[model samples]
Target: MSKSKSKRVSIPRSEAEMPSHVYSQLNTSFRSQDVEGDTNLPPVIRSKLQDLFAQIEKEFENLYNENLNLHDKIDALNEKLEKENYNPERQQTIFESTDDVIPVKTSKHKLSGSSQKLKTAHKLKAQTSKIVSSFKTPSVVCSVVKELRGHRDGVWDVAVARPGVPLVGTASADHTALIWIMESGKCALRYIGHSGSVNSIRFHPTRDLVLTASGDQTAHVWQAAITPDYNKTGASSDEDIEGGGEGESGCDTDIEGGGGTSTLRTPIAELTGHAGVVSHADWMSGGDLIITASWDRTAGLYDVEKKELVNTLTGHDQEITHVCGHHSQRLIVTSSQDTTFRLWDFREPIHSVSVFQGHTDTVTSAIFTKREEKVISGSDDRTVKVWDLRNMRSPQATIRSDSAINKLAVSNLGIIAIPHDNRQVRLFDLTGQRIARHRQGHQRMVCSVAWADEHSFSSNFFSCGFDRLILGWSIQNIKDL
Candidate 1:
């Protein structure tokens, strides 16, 4: 046991670095005094004790220096933690004094039977569940299926082609948009028409066209071949279609390897009337009209065929951030930075307008459900409110979050995916109950989320972030909720 204890003891630096020496005098003297071993043993032990004192001093010095280094690291970490406190008010403006901030007004009417049931169920489930956020799912754990990394700057938005077409498009601050082949994670086509940051992209509901909104104060409608690799003509051509006048047109006949894509260098239509950056663009259900929300504090309705602005929807006090077309109707909703969102009936050409004021801060994103009976709006105030279209005075239910929401997407299966500034993307049902969390694939603020189709393991929902990566997450089992 004594030998074992000695073996476990650490060697001191002084002993390790001690000068090499041979005790030749002691060897000669000990040889001569072999018969008087007892008499010389005391002298040898005393010499060894003297050597140990020096080593102990050096070891204590090393221990002191190590302690000092540890203290320095602790001080640095504490300083950083104080600077990056969880409360966002310290790092950025909370907009608390924006006196125009309006409280949700009280409505005299009661909720319908379905809404009442939704609110009750959400409240009960939340109360029964633990307060801490858990990442574990009961059946399937969400994971990153693939990481798409081609953008040189932050990716702003992502949209998938209609189900069964393995194509995904992303907008970036590098002044370009890329079409990614989802199966192989390769960039298939590069659209380089926008002169400024491309903020949003969406495919036509039924055409082979893709629309992009840009910070250059314009939105472009470009042709994108539906084939797997965009090799329709089999040769590079400079052929310009009739309406592709604003940008240049060129094509690469042979696709390159190592995640490279052919370039579609032109846009077929340029919708250009906004005074500021066009923030978002989407095609209406009929595919004949396009609506765009812009930082100019107005929404523009454009005729796709004529490539002209038809009417401007007004009434927001700040920049509009997002716009979504109704699933089956001629109506559209526009979310704005003015802490409100407005609904417009395109059937009346912007004459029939109603504003919904519920969020306390900028409304970052808003979209209608599949049935058009409700709208979910996310805001900078860290809350998502579900509003019944028939009653805009108050929200049917509110899903409060700890961080600001950047964007949200409601899937065809009625599941909502909301991406937050805290690098987490959470899924919630329309009733406001959180079903699952996807914390696997992002390292920075997640800016956008999109669904390829219904909730299926084969059909991935995507998210892009300020980390310059797009992560496709598999979350089919979330439907178990």
Candidate 2:
């Protein structure tokens, strides 16, 4: 037992850094005592000392191994830094803030229905991947293409039309949604129905509809005045489709259009059932169904045409902070303040198909990758974890961040955009290797970001934040310099 206890004690690596003479003296003294074991020492005490020395030797071995591992980590980090061309000045930026600082709002409520009983089996599978010993920070170039400023308050979410239509929608704390023409940066339409802050926004996968989730505990679906073919042809201007001439400056504080026949603000449907704030909402690829997560600790499945709630997903112990549904599969994933994310087969929204717990703090955002086989999440703990839907036991990989990751966006190319509280946006590959970072992109916390299309290598994306500005970023490949 004494020997086992001694073995459990680890040697301090600091001792190895001491002068060589000190270590030699200690070793020689111990050896000399062993030679004189025949004299003066009590037998029991001698046995205990021998056990202690054996334990020390074992601990030394462990210390040596640990030192090697640490050195490897250091070398990997150095290589990554060099590859990214890392500079302290580039990672940080000067800020100029006004009164538009947007404070984070948190809310909570109980699940609406506990009247029914449900049963589900818990199962887990194992997964494997290449061990990424360190973060792979890649080099990138970012250029600001447009700066849209129309919202009176901070902007919380931005969603660009998929592929063809060069249109962007922004949700703001000003209690309105603005649809902008990307090329001209003109606000095409301003939706003014939400009674509270618009927390999230999304464009329909195959239609001219835009969905906005608000702190008013409702989700509004608005019809955009663009032709279906324009949504598939990557049109540059709305003048040909809408027959509206140039209206205002791209950075003008004034919106472009007035109440006219061309502009529409009335929503097709207003789905309201949550008892608390609705933080996130998304449309399936079919554009027929909508999914939402709310502070009521429940996820609701709604029929877009019927404009009514079809089912309620309840099981989370805390507020459902964010939700994303698969574009191709019948699955949906949600993040919660309970520091856990749950994956549910939307066909059966009554019970969670799987529960993923790894985040140490509130899980602020989660999204399904293009393949619908994996889910990635960001948390207040300043880390992003990726999980395989098949293997629900442990995360496949964990990407560390310098600050809390407030939002995460994944493109079809397997690239991930992480908006952080430190006023920076970072992009990474599916393998957890950081490929690029945009430091000068925002003057305040980057509240949200979204890709313009499904192109794997598309250079253009949109971002908006507490700075009350909508930004378009175009990525460029760097020439050898």
Candidate 3:
């Protein structure tokens, strides 16, 4: 129509691969830019341009940050390498020249080694101190002096034959007694023929005879030495007259003077008066009189030389267990199962000076201290009570034992040896302080203990229950300087 306005009409390609109108449309859009302001564009194109610009900005920022971090890393690496190559002498020189501070690494080995050596030296010094302390304390050294074994059964008692002689007499439960030579430790003679076990034995004070108490209800006296048979023509009254009427032959005179028969034989004397078992017998300190206790609740004083029962002291109501004479006084103390011990004046029949009490059970054994002013009694109540002779109502000291004390002996040095059912032989000073404990040998219930000397002593302690072995222990003081 109006050759028509000949207006150029452009269409945007929508689906066509090749379209002449697409190029015409881009030229038209550029020429018509004034159609919208320069800032105004299609929504889709504006958004796409904004996203692309944001991505480019982000990439530039990332590159700039990476370059800065690389510079810092290189600088740190170079500083560390410089420090590694630095010389301590150069650093000291720099510090001295400029008064600058320099860091230094300590010599760890030298300092640590010295500290370790100091600790080791301190430990060694402590160990040496402990050893020295132990060495400074008192210690005991013991040795077996002699061993005597001859009884068919356990030996119940042993006594020294004389003050310094190496001879001893032992009574056994085998119904026999033996005389032992301590030096050789051999049985010199066997005194047999007792009807029951021999419970106690003692040597005559000045003679070669031994006295033994047996369960047979009799006490026998025997010559310790063996004897030979001898003719009794001159000694017998009947044969003496037959030889006295005529001149006595030379052979008879030789027999009488030479004593060719048996000088070793001594007359055997049997003391019989108690109605019960004799528990113990002992010679007086003077060695002239003998005292004995019996289960019949009676104690007797006998003139050993005259073979006569001098006095029968009777007051206890139970078995008398022990008896001992005073060392300096004429008093005698006897203990019994009746839970009491009595002090008797042997010089006078009616003198019962004191009666000791406070034991809860049977008094098993008692002994007068060497001073004779005090008495110590061991009881089945597991206690050892010390009583002053002046006042016997209360005990001066009471020592508790782990078990019943079967026997007690005081050494001349004022030490007490106590044997009990616990199998230990304990030694205590007169002050009742425990000084030492010795195993009479492992686990044996030690029943008897005796002291053989003053400061140094030996014990004849026997065990019955487990070990059933008789043992001897020798102990002596180790003084501290």
Candidate 4:
């Protein structure tokens, strides 16, 4: 038998050990040099050149195999981590709350009726084009001014107190609510009466009281004070906090750190009657009554003084997601997962119900803009519809987004502050023109957003997310040309 030739095995060169000059030589133009197959080369030199090309091809194959091995190891590590942290039950609950998002682009409706009264469609197009053309750069610039932290779980809602007190209240899933000093980032007081998560909170329109809705099927009115007595007492006992028990009508919170004597630890009253979880509650423009939306598919009208549910407005076919009181009217609107929202006149309750049906999925939030003239509704379908109260037949305009919306706040200038599930906060003009897109600072889905003081030159807003952090954002107005 003929002697077998010894097999040659090539080893991969480490990236650092690879010859640097070889890369430069390979990158050189082949047209300027004699190729390996050229007949002008001597036979010995030609044979050597072929060997050099073979070596380069072997090195390339080695590098490619090494890269693929690294990728396979990384993928295995990621899969292991995912398996270690998986929770199917919690995943199902979240899916039920916001509905699974297929991640699409869609939203609609007009700000009001007049924007739709365009004599010609071309005029509307021209106006939109002018707005777009004028914005050569981002008109609004916002960044996280502060990151407030304290709660053990995600913050669901945040509300700013009147200017003088300089207080910010936040509700959380940690079975507690915190009142933080806006300037110092210190937790002043804590509320812990609810047996379940505190879902929403709103500061009293004219007093130092906060109304908090919870998953425990109850809403509690408590003192929201910023005095020295309650300062840094976030560790106060739960019994000491809810000392007044259920319904004992206390006093207003003295936010100025003055000598006013009022009990700040106990809850004032607990509004009870919801069969399911009370998602949210809001104070009417007049501040005498409070309206609540519950998972029971109805909204409750409560008298603030009596601390009792007076009427239950019913029409939706699914759980009510959010409720909002008209800015200056006795009307209230409730959004639900039934894909429709109903406008209710508290004066007549059941008799004066108007159903606005258009959203194809759950209506996440609905709010009145322009002094109850226009209603803006955000849905899980990734669309926000603007309905003119004057013409309820169709939408005034429509705004589309990439993610499902949670709760949205609108500035006095008709700009919508929309918080999304994709960890983005977007601002849109009433005409559906995107004003700004803020995508930083939150590690999880952004839950709720609130406007600071609208009268200031630089409009400021706050956003909270499932990352258990509250971020304060400010947008400096683009100076006029």
> What are the per-residue Cα lDDT tens digits for candidate 2 across 7-124?
1122233442221111110111244354565567877877787789889967875764465455346545655544354332332221112112323442322221211111111110
Candidates' TM-scores? 0.68, 0.66, 0.58, 0.66
Stretches > 4 Å off in candidate 1? 1-140, 229-260, 348-350, 455-459
What is candidate 2's CA lDDT for residue 194?
Answer: 81
Pick the lDDT winner: 1
TM-score of 3: 0.58
Please give the lDDT score at residue 69 for candidate 3: 44
Least well predicted 10-residue stretch by lDDT in candidate 2: 117-126
* Candidate 4 C-alpha error for residue 452, in Å: 0.5
Can you write out model 4's per-residue Cα lDDT over 323-422, one digit (the tens) per residue?
Answer: 9988678888998888889988756534588888888888888998954489899987778888888898988878865467778887667778888765
lDDT of 3: 0.57
Of 1 and 2, the candidate ahead on TM-score is 1
Tens digit per residue, CA lDDT, model 3, 27-86: 112213234456667868876776776787577546534543443354356445434444
Put down candidate 1 lDDT per residue, 208-280, tens digits, no spaces: 6799998888999987764654333111235532212222233222222222355565688889999987888
Which regions of candidate 2 fall more than 4 Å away from where they truly are?
Answer: 1-137, 227-253, 256-264, 347-352, 453-459, 478-481
Candidate 3, residue 293: how far the Cα is off, in Å: 0.9
RMSD of 4: 25.0
